[model samples]
Target: MHEIISGLLEMTGFSIVGWETILMWMIAFILLYLGTFKEYEPLLLVPIGFGVLLANLPGAGLGIVANELVMNPDGTYMTLIDIANNYGILNFLYYALIKTGFLPPIIFMGVGALTDFGPMLRNLRLAFFGGAAQIGIFSVLLGAVLVGFTLPEAASLGIIGGADGPTAIYTTIKLAPHLLGPIAIAAYSYMALVPVIIPFVAKLLVTKDEFKIHMRKMDREYPPKHEIKHMRVVKIAFPIVLGLVVAVLVPSSAPLLGMLLFGNLIKEIGPNTARLADAASGPIMNTATIFLGLTVGATMTGEVFLNLQTIGIIVGGFLAFCLSVAGGILGVKLFNKFTKKKINPLVGATGLSAVPMASRVANELALKYDKSNHILQYCMSSNVSGVIGSAVAAGVLISFLG
Candidate 1:
């Protein structure tokens, strides 16, 4: 009877019961609820939530494990052969996909394939808003330093403000691998809540008049018919030229920017490679996202995630996101002060790298203030520019801080 009871307890994962494990379970459930019921980045949150649940179920051995070098009893590093012998499947996946830093760039390739750079090209000045939005990253970096975090760790934490999940993961994995889980969670969570967060901030900083401001008419409405052909030529050239320039200026950014430009080039090369572009933006991207979410969540073991520093990261990350929104809004306000052609301040809040979502939120707010307003095209310029700005910022941080 005693033996049977013990076996049952072990099999049921009850043998490892503890407050921390219970807390982690609750956290995972909350994530699941938010993902399912609230419909917030469900594709990412669901997988990550499930991974957290799997990892916390004791004795499963499905969670990640340290490489043999770190686990060796003699306090000496081990060879690849030794590490292979000790690897868990999740650990293998994590090391293979994430630690090697292969997945994020691939994800960027998909992003590039799906992106339309036309809006940005049409409105070149708005691109600067993306750079302006990055002020939050530096602000949070200083804040993290003041609150007790190493430069590398703070850099990883500060990137949560960029609202670019893959960039945050890539930067954190390079600079501060230990903080990857918290940083990724904060980045994605804030991104999922962009609709809620951006509006609140826009309302706070932007006046009713500023919200009602409209952008100049889109080129699509009043352009020479032959302009379409010229636009295609420019689109093809833009990625190639920009890629070369960025690669020259920031070598470390080459891998990510290279993949992005390559994907864009594939998209621009015409209908012959429609299948390739579709594959990049569809199956390939979805697969990468699933693995990325799972590996990231598995890293959040109760032993590592439940700590005072985790609390600090969460707080700092939220502050960074809020400040980024404010920075973008303030940037437009500053720009308007000097120019007769004023931009809608609401468009500035879309400067984070959440893409069309941020732009949509800005448009929605504008409509609420005045139904005739349609600022999505203008906001999209800033939105896409934010993607480039975040990548560049990540490169700069890695170059200086890593």
Candidate 2:
């Protein structure tokens, strides 16, 4: 009777549920609560939170398991069958999808298909703030190295400042694959918190008068003496020219930036290529996001996440995010000091690559100070440029580090 009961208890996984497992469960619950009740990045956090739970459950063996000896004899990766046997299904999926560095660029294609560059083309000068926002990435790179991280590890950590989850993930995969879980979690979580982070930083740095600065009024007061001719042609040609330039200058980034420009190219080409655009933006992107969230969360086993390096990532990533936001705000302020035509600091605040969300947050903040100040278009100018800037920054890092 004793032997039978012992065997049953051991098989059930009850005997193995320790404080560490419970702690991971609590962390998973927190992610779920934030995604569910707070409605913050539900698409990402919900799947990730559930994956964390599934991975931590004792005896499930669903999480990504490490095996240094699983490579093929020829130095290629193992086959899916071999991976599934040695690790779990999650590990196999991760190796097949993520380790290959395939999904992030595919997601970038969807992002490009969905993006409209009209706002940016109309207001080219605001793009400077987007470039200015990249200061956070490099600054954090140096700071991280000074604080004891290796050069590549610091580069991966620093890319979080760009506020582009795909860029961060891609950069980490190349430069610091070991830190992917913490880096992805930090990047997306901060991106989701755009509504809060933008406002928080704006409050600290921007004055009430700066927030009240209406961009349209300034444009009306100092109207452009010249307008871009054949705007449609420019839009169509810009992505192609830019892609070629990036290919020459930063070939490493061609994978991501190339796909993005390709998606944009198809979209700009109109109905002739509409199907490709739709497929990239809809079903393909959705599938990639699901796999990304789940696999990334699976990498968050207690042994991986519950470490001092994770603590550094959590803290360093926040600083990088804050610095990026502050850098944008300060860029506008500095530019305003010299220019008669003032730009709203809020426009700069939207320079994060979080896209429409960051732009929306900045637009809302602008409206809070002046009810009629609609800066969404102006914000998009910086927002979209930030996406390009971040991807380029990732490319630069990969070129130098990887």
Candidate 3:
């Protein structure tokens, strides 16, 4: 009877549960609370939180992926059928979709369909700040290497600065798949906290007078001598021209930029192609996001996520985010010194790729200082360009490290 009892206890999963598992459970609960109650990135956080919960459950094999099934007997890639048989559903999802580097570019296509490039085309000068914003990516790359990370790991961590979740995910999967859980969580969490972070940093770096620079007023005083003739034609041709230019310089970026530009092209074609754009940005994007979130969260097993490395990712990711914002602000400050038409520093603050949220936050900051200072349109110029800039930066890292 004593031997029987010992065997039963030893065989039970509950008996094997350790402090690491408990900690992971707590982390899952916290993420759930943030997603449910706080409403921070509910779409992403909710799925990811649930995935984390499912992965940490005692005795459950839902999160287990058979890593050995990567290749077959002849050294060929396993079919999805084989993967499903050897690996579980979550594992299948990770290997088939996320691991193959499939979904991020698909998500980028949706982002492209939803994006409006008109603002960026007109305010060409403002686009440089977007390029400047990428300074955070390279900055953290060196920072991570100094702190003892491999180049690939550092490259993956650095992309958190881009503030574009899909870009960060794609980069990590290519360069440091092991760090995906931490990197993805960090990237999306920081993106969600854009409103709070932007204001906090603006308070420290931007002066009251600097916030009051009226972008619209400056535009009126220094209007271009001529309006862009055949605006529709220009809009139609922009994607094609830019895609070719990007392809020549950074061919690796094609997987991301190619899809993005194609999505935009469909959107620009107007009513005749509205159906394609709608499907790309709506149902297709939504489905991809749900699967992406759940699978990414499942990757955060207890042993993987509960470590000093995750702590480093959390801190380093935040620094990358802040430095990107600071870089954009300082870039504009430097530009202001050289040019006669002064720019509002808040315009630079919108250079992160958090989309309309970043632009909206900057616009609100401007309004707080002066009621008439609406900078949303100007903000979008850099905001959109930041999307392009971050992808290019990711390609650069991959080319160098991968």
Best by TM-score: 2
Kindly list the per-residue Cα lDDT of model 2 for residues 328-354, writing each as its tens digit.
Answer: 889999999999999999888888679
- lDDT for each residue of candidate 1 in 1-402, tens digit (9 for 90 to 100): 999998988778787879988998998998899899998889888888888887787877666665443355787654445555565667767877888899999999998998999988877888999988998898999999998999999999999999888899999999998888888888888899898899888888998788877665323344323434588899999999999999999988887888888788788877988889898889999999999988888888898799998999999998889988999999999999997678898777888789889999888888898787888988999999998888899999999987
Q: What value does the lDDT take at residue 141 in candidate 2?
A: 91
Candidate 2: 10-residue stretch with minimal lDDT: 64-73
Shift of residue 352 alpha carbon in model 2, Å: 1.8
Question: Candidate 1 — which residues are off by over 4 angstroms?
Answer: 7-12, 67-85, 217-229
Candidate numbers sorted by TM-score from highest down: 2, 3, 1
State the lDDT of candidate 3 residue by residue for 58-113, as single tens digits.
Answer: 77766635355568778787887777776678888988889989999999999999
Better of 1 and 2 by lDDT: 2
* lDDT for predicted candidate 2 compared with the true structure: 0.89
User: In model 3, where is the ten-residue run with the lowest total lDDT?
Assistant: 61-70
Please report the candidate that would top lDDT against the real structure.
3
Taking all chains together, each candidate's TM-score versus the true structure is 0.93, 0.96, 0.95
Please report the TM-score between candidate 3 and the true structure: 0.95
